[model samples]
Target: MAYPQHTTTGMTTHPDLTEMRERLERTASSSGAIAVEGLILLTGVYTAISPWAVQFSSQTNITVSNLIAGVTTALIGLGLALAPERMFRLAWAIVPLGFWLVVSPWVVTPTHGARPGIVWSNCLAGGVTALLGLIAMGLTVRVARQSPR
Candidate 1:
């Protein structure tokens, strides 16, 4: 019986697998663009939402925190658009990601604490954003590694 060949990711089957590997590499590169792009976008939305913290939060530092978040998100957005490759490689890229996780629980907290939407809205938005960002970061890393010089 003859063995069937594998065809996927725009590549045909090959004995040496060079063709297949190259196709996969290209496919990954394209995928990386989206992953990186998404992370950047999520980071932006997170930042933009920060300014509106006063609406959901009654905390004194909500304004300050929101400002910082805005700046961070803007920076990420710029970075992603400018040179996603560098942004992806940044050593501290994952630092801000911690915020979404930390903030999520707060959203669920009741108004007795200090904010209206702070406890839940942000939690949901941030959570989704964070997940997308993480996925993008991962894909960026994979694509970066696969890319040829």
Candidate 2:
């Protein structure tokens, strides 16, 4: 598949060909590590804010399973940040997160005291986090495929 037409962009974008060439040269000179670092940073921020500010953590609503998921996210976030170059390939984790973020309102189904705002906000947060993960994942994968290791 002749991709890269739209799906990927490095650290540079230009309106003209000459500027585009220069931007590409600059990005190619120092892109791989920076891209991975950006991805890890995104994961870190997402992990930090999600459980406290984004979750519906009422005593009645919060439970053991959610705690487990939060713990799991912490571990995964650590992995992504520490060894982003290696672990970044395991990017499919974003899919479920994306799914949940997109459908959290329906999934939560708040009956009595519906926190639709919280649900939507958290869902959107998760979706944005997943997007960041995907960007890093795809970029690292592309670079790996293009460059010999």
Candidate 3:
């Protein structure tokens, strides 16, 4: 029996892989996608600082909660902006994270004693985060459908 000779020293590159990479690059570079990614990053940064900005940092529990959630959201947003091909699949995670932010004020605070500013801040930020998550999901789905199998 004779072994087949390799054409090149390096590993073979699949055509589909190249096409997929190109498609992902196109999707990431699209104007609308860039805008959405930027908005997501801004929202995350706002959320992270909102506890102090809204003057609700006294509530230790809610303060810590917002800090963690906000940081996670910001990191996710950054990841999506920097590597959409790898990060877009995680877009759906933002929806639940946003929902948690919306309800955390009441649940994390004692006796439902969240200040109006805290409530407004969390609700607004959460709503925006959820909406951005939905938009990101749509963009991911659209790109997936457009790419050839």
Q: How should the candidates be ordered by TM-score, best one leading?
A: 3, 1, 2
Assess candidate 3 and give its lDDT.
Answer: 0.87
RMSD of every candidate to native, in Å, equals: 11.3, 12.0, 4.1
Over 1-149, each residue of candidate 3 has an lDDT whose tens digit, in order, gives: 99998787353476577777678778877998889888888888899898899888888898898888888888988998898888988989988889998999888986868888999999999999999999999988887788495
Model 1: per-residue lDDT, tens digit, 1-149? Answer: 99999958553454546643554345435755556555656655664565464364445454455445545655765666565544655424544544553474344333545354554554554565455556656655565456343
Model 1 segments more than 4 A misplaced: 1-32, 35-39, 53-58, 91-95, 98-101, 104-112, 144-149
| Better model by TM-score: candidate 1 vs candidate 3 | 3
The true-structure Cα RMSD of candidate 3 reads 4.1
TM-score of each: 0.55, 0.54, 0.85
Better of 1 and 2 by lDDT: 1
With a 3 Å backbone cut-off (N, CA, C), the pairs that clash in candidate 1 are: 106-119, 107-119, 107-120, 108-119
TM-score of 3: 0.85
Candidate 3 stretches with Cα past 4 Å from truth are: 1-15, 110-112, 147-149
- Residue 62 of model 2, lDDT score: 30
- Candidate 1, run of 10 with poorest lDDT: 105-114
User: What TM-score does candidate 2 reach?
Assistant: 0.54
